[model samples]
Target: MRPNREDWAAALAAADKGRVAALADRIRDRAQVDLLAPPREGLMLMQLRESVAGAAFHLGEIPMARVHLRLTAPEGVAEGGAALMSDDLALVTRLAILDAALVADLPEAPEIEALLAEGMAARAETQARRALSLDRTKVDFQLLSEEDE
Candidate 1:
């Protein structure tokens, strides 16, 4: 039998924490005694960014599906792009959930919807930093950092 929306949501939540922990472990291991040579920290940072991106890629579509299955939002897709936590798909998911929560008949929707905007700004910033760290263009973050006046 097919599971319900609640089941989907539950499954998503259950896996999220594990995925995050695993990603962190992978980054730490790669950074510490794993990847030798210079630029170890940057390598680890890239790995961590990848981990985050991968998680969002997998779990990002979930929140949108939850909205769709519940028929909370008007039947429509959303916009997306190469954003941090807000991958195009992830952004769509967030928008779907936000729209649904805003108009849904459920009482708990408000609280759940609040998370749509939460961390989005932070995610973008984090992703930008990660991308910069991985830049092979020789961008000097130290110089950039010092120039901020």
Candidate 2:
């Protein structure tokens, strides 16, 4: 089945630093890209809400990095951007390039699709491992039965 936009986005977001960089490098080698906004690091407020419709609250600020890139593709000019929670400037730059390549539908799109699949699989494995750890700690109330005289 073909992956949707959300799946592709989640894959890129979940990818590790090394994988993102490598993919970005591959895209750069094949296309002409311009840095619309050079990598910039800043602090952004982490907002939280009890629910989707609940009131929001600030959970303090965290370091964030972002980059914007534009590339010339066969179709036209494609703009791509990426923002990350960490302060890794290089990683954000690479992600931006990858995003642009995806938007441009370059020849390397299939490679990117493969990368996304790999990233999503890795994320699923991590989540399964975490779930297993949590399951181990589950408290079974049936085991706590008590008899009183």
Candidate 3:
């Protein structure tokens, strides 16, 4: 089925955004203060909105036919088991993450650097997850959501 542009945009936005109000609540519970810290925590309001806008742009909702540029295969190469490991597809996926991370934090260099680091780790994890899925060998996947797991 063809992807709906609005649902794609909303999914990308929800995946990309944190519940800032909930984060503020957690901070208040942990360390409440009369004058809270400057806007160093979440992305600035405009930046957060721009992220959603950027996602829409990425999905080709801007000035072009909407097409899903996926990472699972490469052009000029036939689709097969090992197509995902091709250098071109890998590079494109990596650059996409880097591009997204570059704009993840706006008007803050340290946050950008931090986002880059997170981006690298996330990219690595995605590759690993993709490989695991491609393996198609079933396992009793225990859901351990922790760095130490």
Scored by TM-score, the top model is 2
TM-score of 3: 0.24
lDDT of 3 by residue, 96-116 (tens): 322222233212224334433
Residue lDDT tens for model 1, 35-145: 111211111112222455454222222212212322222332222111122223433333333333333433434343333233343445667989888885776789988
Off by over 4 Å in 1: 1-67, 72-99, 135-149
Please state the error at residue 76 of candidate 2 in Å: 4.8
The clash count of every prediction, one per candidate, is: 2, 0, 0
lDDT of 2 by residue, 1-149 (tens): 33665455456767665767777887777678888866789899999986867989998999999888898866556888878787877777777777778777877777777778777888798899999999999986766764321
Show model 3 residue runs off by greater than 4 Å: 1-16, 19-107, 137-149
Candidate 3, clashing residue pairs?
none
Best-to-worst order by TM-score is 2, 1, 3
| Candidate 1: C-alpha RMSD after superposition | 18.6
Better of 2 and 3 by TM-score: 2
By lDDT, who's the top model here?
A: 2
Task: Note the Cα lDDT for every prediction shown.
Answer: 0.33, 0.76, 0.30
